[model samples]
Target: MADYSEASPPPKNRQIVLLLSFFVGLTIALFLSVDLMVGVLIGWIPPGVERQLGALIVPAFEQQAAPSSAQDTLNQLLDRLKPHLSAEQQQRDYKVLYVPDETVNALAIPGDRIILYRGLIEQAESENELMMVLGHELGHFAHRDHLRQLGRGLLMQITISSLFGDISGIQSIALSAAQTIGNSRFSQNQEYKADEMGVTLLQKIYGQVAGATDFFARLSEKKDLPIDFLTTHPNPGKRVQRLEKLIQQNGWTVGDRSPVAESLKMP
Candidate 1:
């Protein structure tokens, strides 16, 4: 306890601490800069490159999907929404791979494919509501949200691997990216933008925004189910409120909903 007030770290220890602090600070700065570049980088990615990356992941879903009338019907519905997409989006080949599973979820993967689970289709009470869900997925594609979900770390890895022509490394990263995409949750702002796009598309298809929020409203009531859709998506109640506000702001009219196609009805 002698002269404790004058105690100081040795010169060597101080240098070590300074080096560690510098590295930590540099790492954080690099992370933030990479994140900031993600939006801009994604815009520069061509559809061809996106499809190549998607090819690595699409096979897994393709194996799960069973080609049937249900899959056909889902694709047909997706086609209907195509006309309303932007000219650039319309040029890309989009399809739906319908999986006959009880998981209530839909996904827009990199390869311009929408994965629609049977459970989600069963939950839809009307054609328009189902279309709204489809439109929402399409919104993801329009905004390049699927790639954005890959996170900054994986994105930077992919970019670097591709730049170095490391095909094997890219494939490995793609596999991990697939798993991440399956469980990823979009940002609340991303969800809202998708909802806005969905409602706009619904209006174009039906001349009214009927059933736009019906699916979400119903799901919002069932809070106990261990549903993947609920797990990965933003709160349904919040989404419904936002959609209603958007519809009101835009003077969108609500009308009767169309019946779900027989092909999509649960047996």
Candidate 2:
């Protein structure tokens, strides 16, 4: 009989074959896992998972967004608005965040996160205008605007990852999509809803029914970037037009009185 050891394949060749098998297995596993996660999460169109993810990332760093001084101001405003907002709406998937950057923008993330750039505070005409803006952002949360953005992003990530099958490429795609969707403009329709709701909230809280258009008007007419990547607010003119219509149609004339905030005079 031939010696069994002599008949066996060379150790070097066996090692190489084993290495190939391991890599192939690992690749398959990773592909399957990523694909499966994307499919499962997005497949049935489950409600609020989008909100959950947004919430997770938005308020992650406790002390990240604003400095202590600015935060103190925001907290005071929030305290004033607290009692009037429905408890459910009050604890929206959003938190007031302050970013020290000079960009004049405030926006909502997937969760209860609303970032107020220092530039935004500087741009405020009055405390009421600030409320109007915050109220508008809250309207987005209430209307599931951020959740819709999250859905599109989740779909985009899954698609890009599945097509590429390269982990690093998929990660990069996800990052880009995440950033884009977070900053993407709300359509005219969504903007209208926010304007209406924000106006309603403002009217209710302050009993002063001023058009929130002034905020957008300032940006729209600016020689510098009234709208740029970091400061892309919805078109002020369109938003103003819509809000004005709602006020007339809904008879949303002011007469509310809250005991909290320092009231702004309404037109």
Q: Tens-digit lDDT track for model 2 on 1-267?
A: 545476694568889999999999999999887656654545433334445345345544344574565666676675666566677776653457777766677776655667777667776766767778778788877766754555555666544544545455444444544566546776677778877777887877766676356676675677675454323555676666777777788776644333222222212
Consecutive 10-residue window with the lowest summed lDDT within model 2: 258-267
Q: Write the per-residue lDDT of candidate 1 for residues 1-267, one digit (tens) a residue.
A: 434344763457889999999999999999888767998678656666677789998998999998999999888888999999999999989999999999888999988889999988888899999899889989999999999999877777777766677778778887998889889999899989999999999999999999899988987888585567767988989999999999999999999989999988888
User: Where is the poorest 10-residue window by lDDT in model 1?
Assistant: 1-10
Provide the TM-score for each candidate, comma-separated. 0.86, 0.63
Highest TM-score among the candidates is held by which one?
A: 1
Candidate 1 segments whose C-alpha is farther than 4 A from its true place: 1-34
lDDT of 2: 0.63
